[model samples]
Target chain A: MIKIAQLSCGTEYSSVQSEIEKAAFSVGGKMVYPDVGADDIDAAVKEFGFNPRSPQLKLMIARAVQLAKGVYDADAVFIATCFRCAEAALVRNELRRYIQEHTKLPVVTYSFTERMKSAQLLTRMEALVTIVSRKELLARERQTGLTAGLDSGSSTTKALVMKDNKIIGKAWMPSYDVVESATTVLNQALEQAGYKLKDLEAIGTTGYGRFTLGRHFDAKLVQEELTVNSKGAVWLADRQKGEATILDIGGMDNKAITVRDGVPDNFTMGGVCAGASGRFLEMTANRLKIDVTELGKLAEKGDWRNAKMNSYCSIFGIQDLVTSLGEGKAFEDVAAAACHSVAEQVYEQQLQEIDIRRPIIQVGGTSLISGLVKEVGSVLGEMPIVPPDSQYIGAVGGALLSSGFLM
Target chain B: MKKIFIDPPNSMILFDIVERLGHEPLSTMAALQERVDNLEIDMPPMNVTLDDVISGLKYAGIEVPSGIRGRLATWGPHIDEADAAIVMAEAPYSFGCVGCERSNEMVKYLLRRRGIPVLWVEYPGDKEAAMRMLEKTKEFLGGLE
Candidate 1:
């Protein structure tokens, strides 16, 4: 059995301790607490640079020191703490960084509450297992066989066909019912590529509708969007062999991920609300009486400073735009303001979660909007790479990873 | 007799019942009274000093938000001294909001982690639920030595 280190505080008292162990066990992992000598009690405080009243947290740091020193044998690490305790949160994040720097073991950090169940921890544990147990597959540089990938996103569905490391066919359309949307894009892409579903060696599904689509297609790989998107991003941006940060500003939310050598080490996703998303930009375009695509060109030409909008609420944001236009501001400037507002909100709310690396790759449908892309660059002070076919990222990511399952 | 820790420390139901059971109930109101009654400080507001808040670092980190630090400073040590605890979870906010969830979760975490006997019951929504809560409380307190 693969040994996965459980370095955490506060779970033993909470109802979720057994739940964590069960989740690990379900994924063929054994959760082991690294034992430390009683003598190391004070030494842990000195080494870890913090003293907590909880002996459990103190012992946790000592165990981390032991693991970093190679005194323990483990394939992966799961670092967790109670969501309520600020001290535990600090220790958990610091331990994650320390372990990642000291060892090559895959690490996943989580802050949980007393109400959390095992089901919530399962996918995280499964991802750690997948990263450790299938490193070779994830490390595979190029696709070698016929594989199909389906991405069922919030606002759109995408399907792609890949062969010999090259995308042969792809289709993007508005999302409808989960299975119907997936089937529609899958059929379109397959027909365009002149390949039948029977000809595919393996299939992978990802995005919001992954569970339903994976079941419908009997997919070989049903992976979360975090892993898939990172894989797809690095592959498309040619940053697979290096470290980079990924920014996918989606329709309903935003995701900021920091990756190392194409593997996602840290992932965070959320937005204040839909106000900081592409739907807001689309709404801005409608208010400006222009297509979403035209807003980009207009934004590039006009200055964002000329039109000011707050991304706190969509209604309030639109009102700002209307007021600006009533003040006789150009549509170009208003479009620029809309993109910049979304970018600023994303930078403020979402990007604060992860450490941004070089060559930040912006994917998802919004990445194609030149205005949003420029505004993101201005806000981040670093130009992001919008790789070719960026919109097909989820589909490509699913296809690329699932291709490994092909025999 | 055993000391019973009640959350919010202001719940009359918990305070009155635990007191009737012939045990000291560690309620915030009681603890605050003891602190404020001390004639050492000159301030009429009964406010704590900066030195007092930094002391909470033993319980939480310095990075913890200021408000939570203040709460933990006053309650953390008290929770440590608890032999047994009775927590009424999710008290309705409209009629009477018992305590902030963040405070409740933190206190419960500390109380439960000590391996102390804890009687966890939800705030009663009806007479039936109230009766059940009372029965559980009686059984739990009675079962304790």
Candidate 2:
């Protein structure tokens, strides 16, 4: 296993690092380094007169050199991480050096890019990694500290704890009272990680529920929703290949993220409407008497017919579903049709504005249904669909991010 | 001292301030053509771009009044050309209001990048804030002097 010797700056960083170390070591790894500070970054940047706006070519070259040096010195898996703000270019160069040092093992690095093109690249890499690194049995024992992530999404409050870049503990709950739900899931995740809340150094709050539940935690608030989701998607993908287009369907609205070149490039959102979202699926499921979880899988096996589901309105869609059912449509076919309808509508409105060249990653509670991905894939021909461990993507991403950040 | 251009017809205070500054109005025509002509001595032909809007006050083949063209031509170039800009904006109503707020930010970003000082007239419509706004504007202009 790749061991991460983690450190952060200030008391908060230390605390966060310690928590991660505890979680990481418990899962069979070694961690031996103090939390880092601005002084470390200062010393590194001063060597090259690193300007914040340095070109990507220069930054990548520098990161390769740094990653090599880091691996050689540490004798462990070295991953260099940075925030998306002014420090991104610098991190890029540093990551390269660390990677070179750990030639035997892969060195991971993440930069926050607001562009959809970059996000796609990162998504593919992480998804490939996840597929290869299946079945994380390290949770039975704890050796080094690990880090966990918390994603307070609009519809659900979820927490994921990780060690050695693998999932450890995960919990999800609908966001009713956001603070209470977040705390509950966070506590559950902490227990799973064999750590406590006091051990946490950094906590990231995201989604629309982020600002609303801001007062509850003493953690960092990632201002941009795109950054949070991009990081989350990358982590859940583990190390997958292919352009990642994350479709986050929530109760009140829906958000689409495109991760290209390991950074978020572009995003589009449906402005506050449950009609074109997971909530619509829920209502349809209730009326159809099929558990939402079984809907996708069942739809996958069933033969689908082209049933017209017009009227972008959810209320209208519900009436359409009812009338269509009254006309003797099969449950699996209708479910399949509804899935296709939503995907088609979304693509029509926003995806037309975007280049649908990459594979689409469907997330959120609605994504858990088995056949939805297949049906959506069939409707949007040639586009691959990557549906991860159900709807816990945000939570899993949160945990993986926490592991990286804390380390 | 460099000459600064003002836009639209006018207000009493804005006119008085410009007069008090002891600067000459470089005729609307000259101000509009200054940048391009300064590069080369060839003066582009003067044309009335806005005359077609004023119908009925025609002469022969010309459809609109050149006089009306002269009045509209007083403002040239976007606000981007200014070394500094002072926009009258109100709070709550105008703090994040679409056009005003966006324009204010864009102007500020442009001017600051150019190392120019900007004067902001917040709550311009409020009577109680008028004196305060004047004082701020004076101080800002004094810095330029």
Model 2, A322: alpha-carbon shift in Å?
1.2
Ten-residue region with minimum lDDT total, candidate 1 chain A: A9-18
Structural similarity of chain A in candidate 1, as TM-score: 0.84
Task: Give one digit per residue, the lDDT tens place, for model 1 in B42-111.
Answer: 3223343344455656776755543345556666777888889998866533322222345456778888
List the candidates' TM-scores in order.
0.69, 0.47
Candidate 2, residues B1-145: lDDT per residue as tens digits? Answer: 4344332212334435544665332223344455345554322223222222132122112221222222222232323345444445443321222111222343345445655445556655667677787778667656666
lDDT of 2 by residue, A80-110 (tens): 2222223442344344344433443323333
**Candidate 2 chain B — worst ten consecutive residues by lDDT sum?**
B93-102
Identify the runs in model 1 with alpha carbons over 4 angstroms from their true place.
A1-41, A50-60, A78-92, A110-125, A310-330, B1-145
Please tell me what DockQ candidate 2 reaches.
0.02
lDDT of 2 at A38: 26
- The per-candidate count of clashes, in order, stands at 0, 80
